[model samples]
Target: MNTFHLGLIINPLAGLGGTAALKGSDGVAQEALALGAEPRAAERTRIALECLRPVAERVTFLTFPGPMGADLLAQLGFAHQVLGSLENGATCADDTRQAMRLLQEIGCALILFAGGDGTARDICAAAREGQPVLGIPAGVKIHSGVYAISPRAAGELTRRLVEGGLVRLASGEVRDLDEAALRQGKVSARWYGELTVPEEGGFMQHVKQAGMESEELVLVDLADWLRDSWEEGVRYVFGPGSTLHGLAANLSLHTTLLGVDVIENGQVIAHDVTERELFNLVDGYPARLLVTAIGGQGHIIGRGNQQISPRVLRAIGLEHLRVVASKRKLGTLEGRPLLVDSGDPLLDDTFPDAVRVWAGYREELLYPVGWGS
Candidate 1:
């Protein structure tokens, strides 16, 4: 029987423990709940495994115990080998790290981890000695090519690796983003290294480096307009991306690239808001939603940010919404109307109608927020 040796690690609190402005979930007992940072590590683990269902029989899931890693696999019926015995509940980064080290000591061929930048760093530090590595991208700022384009893509790459398919080993850039700067909506970069990443899986994008490129300038200008145009007592719910951060820069506030932020009356009310946080913030205070179109992928909402639930969007109302983007950015989407993925099937009907986007100083284009499939 052909078999492939694979290791797994899930940083249970890795991405879920961020310091969103609403209440820095990081290290805060109460605030973490307030921000609604769902314990996504488990869900991510399940998603990755489900994606690899086709080749499950040929793979061994050498992983941590319980909440640390194995629970997700167990939930999805993965009866592979579990490593690192634990006396108490293993539900943290320390536990995951220990399991990863143990996997290395046993000479596992590849380390597949579910996390954002923090998880990526640990994998680089522990497995850099030519051990193959890949990421599930369960973090907010996953500025790393080591990750597959999505959880499903990550599984596809793993299947190829196990099958000994033409999975060429290429150097995927590992980029870490400053959390502090992330809140301020600016991306600072440092090259981590080229880890052995399998190609042919569209699970990555070249980390968007901070620069004053033409596209960036266009975003900066649009942000300036919103900052200057915003009125007091009005709420501003920010979506993820450099374009959204451009608006934050003008206000001298911070933004998270892959998370949601809420602002009001020239003051930041919240950062890294989840679906629940978004609703509470909107209902408690009237606000406007400012978002940008996803680059290359025609997504206005839902694709990457499944957190923006439809209930929240309905409460905020599209009448008070605004879209910002560069004309070129929209053009790259090539007429594929923006998509919405709010987890609610009804959102497909109530999504904004031909919202006007300020692509340039005077060049305005009406884009359909969602198109019928």
Candidate 2:
């Protein structure tokens, strides 16, 4: 029984921009921190490690020093070796690159890094074709296909890899968006490179697509149904996306293109609300959450609208949840089920076997929802 050597890297600042609604943590990490952004990468990485705990004895971890990777592994009591050195405080791109070089040199079987697009770019720069890698999605803008859908999924994939299961390696895209342009309410994304990703049936994520133009008629039909079905006194919480934005347009209400909004009595009470703000607004009211899936990925909760959150979802109850997707968008999934990675395993399990996706006017499709690995 050969022990699998898994390289681990943690970009401690990956998801700091999410709660702050900074769109992404690249370039504006300092600003996000000043706005009281808390470190989330370590906790997300811990979640992945927790899922891998059952197979702990079959693996030996190789990681960087301190907050980069070693601290979390130490806390989790995993057998690990800290391979490189870094400053005591903030870790940079250079640190990640150096760590990757060292990990590859030491012959790690597979490298598991935790971060967003920037971290993915750094790892790609330092790694070669034959070296397999996977991402633990702990960042704000995760448009890359190299990541597992969630941390728990990452753990499960890693477990399969280490146990010599029939997981196959495939070329996965690395995409980074312009955070500056995103903050200005503009989307600019580009391809950085590709990496070798371990693929299982429904475990890996698909790269995000910018826009889908063919869904216009579908949007109008869905909007018409929503307009007729509007209820009084029940707060309607709209998650981020153009589909929901279309519904807002049809209802003659204003909504942010990429931010959460709350509507009550057919009026926008809260525009561009945060997770905490959303929770506050829906505290005692009967609330219904209206969300749309990612155009190509079919992720309803975890990808962009972390503001909905697992706690918020539990409060809204599964019955109060409404999902909308265009027929064109659903077609992109190719029989794969809709995904939910709310960062809370228990809450994820509470979702019903299948939810109804409003595809058109008075049209609904029962789609299976996938969680866990």
Candidate 3:
């Protein structure tokens, strides 16, 4: 039988800083750990690899030893070949670049990595131009366009490739931010490079559009109206993004620029909440989720705001979910539908065919929502 060699790389410390409220995990793995952040890259990788289990007999993973990749593959009982040995310490960018070099040497059909934009940079630096690589979003910094909508989306796209389905390849941008600047409320994002990634409308996210929108007045109007219309006793979950941030600012509530927050009756109930914290806090409360689509990508769920997890969505009830985006931001999508890849196929299916996007004051558009396979 012909074997499909898939290269796997996992930065075990990729998202350690997210829940710790440290912003990005690029340089502060130790600090994040000290702050009670648990390693979750391997778990995210497991979620992606689970989709390939049906094709295990045909797919063989080429990966690095230990936590980087091999451990998860072994746990899933997938056939894999460990490329190189890791040292007696935590893996770094060098390890990731080295793994990419090894994978390129073996000519992997497609390379699947679990991490944020930093990991994408490492892969871009080492990968040959046009080489296919896909990212499973597992980081605090995911402005890069390289990652799939969610972990399951990455696995589903990979499974399609292994199953000989028609898959087109596209270049995905590798972008990262200055974590220090990000911590100080300054947005400093830079484009390092690009990687060849598989393209599926709802599967791959577009590079996060930065800077202020032309519709600043519209945003101000929407924020003013939403704040005025805030329902009492209802917990409002404000998701991450500049649009939502602007709305929260209008309410005069201090919130995280890139983290999830919960507000109730104009008071900050929870700030910089993690997935678990969100689940616990909203479980029994009458809550509403407010999220905006990525400017160019049109992903309303499952890009950087994994904190608004599938379980959280269920607890909040889909009907209570609200999407807010400016008309200009929605225009960037160029007629593409807003996407929902909540990592749970069942829950994703339950989303309304079209969602009501609050564009401006009393201006709502019924936008179609796409659930990519």
Clash count for each candidate, listed in order shown: 11, 0, 0
- Report the poorest 10 consecutive residues by lDDT, candidate 3: 201-210
lDDT of 2 by residue, 165-194 (tens): 334556799999888888898899999889
Model 3, span 1-373: residue lDDT tens: 2466789999998999999999899889999999999999999989998999888897878998899988888889999999888889469999999999988776676789999988888888998875678999999879999999999999998886665443455667899998999899999889898887876633113323444445678778887788778899989999999888888777688889899999988899899999999999899999989999998888899998999988999999987877888766776776566788889999877775445567678655445567654
TM-scores, all candidates, are 0.49, 0.54, 0.54
lDDT of each: 0.67, 0.81, 0.82
Best by lDDT: 3
lDDT of 2 at 308: 92
Relative to the true structure, candidate 2 has a C-alpha RMSD (angstroms) of 21.4
Model 2 spans with C-alpha error above 4 angstroms: 201-373
What's the ranking of the predictions by TM-score, best on top?
A: 3, 2, 1
| Lowest lDDT 10-residue stretch of candidate 2 | 201-210
